[model samples]
Target: MDIDHPLALLGGLTPRRFMKRHWQKKPLLVRRAIEGFASPLARADLLALASKEGVESRAIVRDGERWRVKHGPFSARALPAASRRDWTLLVQGVDLHHPAAHDVLSRFRFVPDARLDDVMISWASDGGGVGPHFDSYDVFLLQAQGRRRWRIGRQRDLSLRDGVPLKILANFEPEEEYVLEPGDMLYLPPRWAHDGVAEGECQTWSIGFRAPARGELVRELLQRVADEAAEETSPLYRDPAQEAVESPAAIPPRLQAFARDAVAAALKDAPLLDRALGEALTEPKSNVWFESSRVPARLRGVLVDAKTRMMHDSRHVFVNGESWRASGRDASLMRRLADRRRLDARELAAASDAARALIRAWCEAGWLHETGESHG
Candidate 1:
């Protein structure tokens, strides 16, 4: 992607311009954004995935004015019939299950991988919808199979309906409305209230980005730091002074100081923080598992698994919840692999022996696949 050139996906604006103009600021609707777009997963294929364990799915049924939501690992027979009106099936993380969906997600690599989440697909019957709601993260709603009419507004009132499973807006005031067809997409920033309803049988693909809450991030990082702290064989806290306290119930101020010192010590390890963050970012989903494989006799190159998360900073290369200190030619090559998600024969040949051995180990662990000239 040329940063200076306008792209149809951005409604004829360059990525830089789009980011400056609309990202986290407003919404953009692009017609024919994916010209002649086709859905990656068919209806039957989607339903099959919904039935599988570990795949997150939901079914929402509209009962006149009231709505009901159900979690899924559903049998097809348990789902509402195709003839049933006003119901929708939503499947999350379609990108993880479908290769084409993953490819579609890669097009948005202009955004950093750390912030990009997975793609979700919603299949709906005529007159179906999940009602008016707002997401706390950025999203691109792409029409895939049929038409979905959308009403959007910059809502000030964030109140939700009482006793509802879905977080639906109680007072939805529409500022504009549009009917989206296949290849048309709408980008909405976080908390921009919007409602979408299927005009007929339709499928919509949503590429959502992650927005980590500050507190959540801090807690996770601290958890990682604390795990490392536990390994320290520090002597137990000792106050040898013979002064006895008058109040037996009083907590010691010296103990509080010791607690602060321990936290200060954790913060003092600068590289530890960086390593923990990298590990956190590359941590796999709870349901994700890699299949073990045998190593080949000779390695030519490697391709990262679609499910693998790989990234690198100045001192460390991170992949699949592990971090490695890299420098010189090896660091440069690994950084390229992180960026491209593949290492060609020439690039692989340039790596040091140790780096090559580590890569081979990862391949055997199923985080990557060894590629050769004849393999393709």
Candidate 2:
């Protein structure tokens, strides 16, 4: 994408301008962000996906002054009647299960893939809603079908209403309101409280970004780095000359220093940390799984699977929770694959023998497919 080129998706602001002005700082409302936009999946299709095992879904129903939430693999008989009011079914990671949904997700690739998360679809009945709440991550809410009335505010009070099944704001004060029609979109930065109520039956697509907390990020990276370090040769602490200590229960100062050095050694390896970060970022969600396939004896082109997560750094290429060292021309080719998600005949032909072998291995792992094959 041309970061300088204006986009209807960002209300005519270029991606560069939008990132500088509104991203994680304020809200943006774009009318007709997608001209004549329609949902990729119909209501019935969404219900079927929600009923499938391994997919994440939830049903929320409002009953007068009370609200209730339920998890799914919901059966067809488990959902509320079509005419029922004040109910919603939320299916997470729709892109992982449907090709059209994956295409819809690809539209937002202007953001880096590492931070871009999956698309979620919310199907709701008349008067349906999940109530006023704030997300810790940024989101673009696009109205796909029918209409929804949204009340929004930059909320200061983050307290939740006790006894509610959902994390609903207790003091939701709307400063602005709008009725979004099909193709309209609203972008909300993290912690911007908003409530959407369906005017009638409706569906909305939410493109959410990941914003891992500092501690969570550190913990994951450290764990990966330490695990890698453990596989390498390292000295064990040896206190051969110990003084007769009066405090047998207390940890020795020398032992503490050795432990500190062990951790420091792991953290000091810059390349290891970088590889770990790339692998962790590209790791698929826990519920995601891929089927193995036989590799073709000959290949002309390839397409990365929608369910596969691939990323690259200067020193390494990572995909599906695994990392490999990459440099020079091979690194460039791998990076291109990560960026474009496909390699045509001409591009594949440019790969060296080793790189071609790696590509075939990825194909056999079901991370990518031969040109004529269907995307996963």
Candidate 3:
């Protein structure tokens, strides 16, 4: 993508301009972000998907001042009827299940894959809503069908209503309001409170970005590094010169020093930390699974699986929670595959013997498939 080129998706702002001006700083509403946009899944299809095992879904029903939340795999009978007012069904990670949803998600390639999360579909009946709430991460709410009235504000008081299953704001102060139609989109920064109520029946597609908390990121990276570093040979704690202390429960100074040194050694490997971070970023969600296949003899082109998460750093390529060392021409090829999500015959033909073998292995592991093959 050309960063300088304007996009209709970003309301005529170039990728660079959009990132600089509005990305995390403020809100931007784009009317007709996707011109003539039609929902990839019909109302019935989305409801059916919500009932399937391994798919994350939720139902929220609002009655007067009360709200009820339910987790799914909901049965067909479990969901409320289309005519039922004040009810909504949300299906998470729609991109992982449908090709059209994946294509819809691919348009946001201007954002780094590490920060890009999955698309979620929310379907609602008349007056349906999850109520006023703020997300911890950025979200692009694209109106897919019908109309929804949105009330938005930059919320400072993060207090929640008591006895509610949802994290709804106790005091929602709306600064701006709009009724979004099909193809319209609203981008909201993290911690911006927003409430949307369906005018009648409606569906909205939320393109959310990952925003890992400092402590959460540190915990994940440390665990990953420690798990790998434990396999390395290291000196055991020795206290040959230690004398008995009066306080038997007190930790030995020498032992504490040894513990610090051990941790320092684990963290000192910059490359290992980098690899761990890359692998963590590309790790698929818990419910994701792949179907294995052998590489075809007459491989022409390859497409990365929709469920596969592939990324690269200066030293390694990470795919589906796994990492491999990459360098020189092969590194370039892998990077291209990650960026474009597919490589044609001409690009594949340029790979060296080692690179070809790696690609074949990826195909056999179901991370990549022959271009014409049917896959999720």
Q: Which stretches of candidate 3 lie over 4 Å from their true place?
A: 244-247
Error of 1 at 138 (Å): 0.2
- TM-score of each model, in listed order: 0.96, 0.98, 0.98
**Predicted structure 3: clash tally:** 0
Q: Model 3's lDDT to the true fold?
A: 0.93
lDDT of all predictions, in order shown?
0.89, 0.92, 0.93
Clashing pairs in 2: none
Q: How many backbone clashes does candidate 1 have?
A: 0
- Cα lDDT tens digits, model 2, 112-148, are 9998999999999999999999999999999999999
Model 2 misplaced stretches (Cα beyond 4 Å): none
For residues 1-376, write the lDDT of model 1, one tens digit per residue.
5677888988899988988999999999999999999896788898999999999999999999889898989999989997799999999998887877888888788788888889999999999999999999999999999899999999999999998989999999989999999999999999999999999899999999988898988888899999887887876899997378799788798888899998998888889999988888898888777877887877777888888889988999999888999999999999998988899878888888899999999888788888842111
Could you tell me how far off, in angstroms, the CA of residue 31 lies in candidate 3 after the best superposition?
0.8
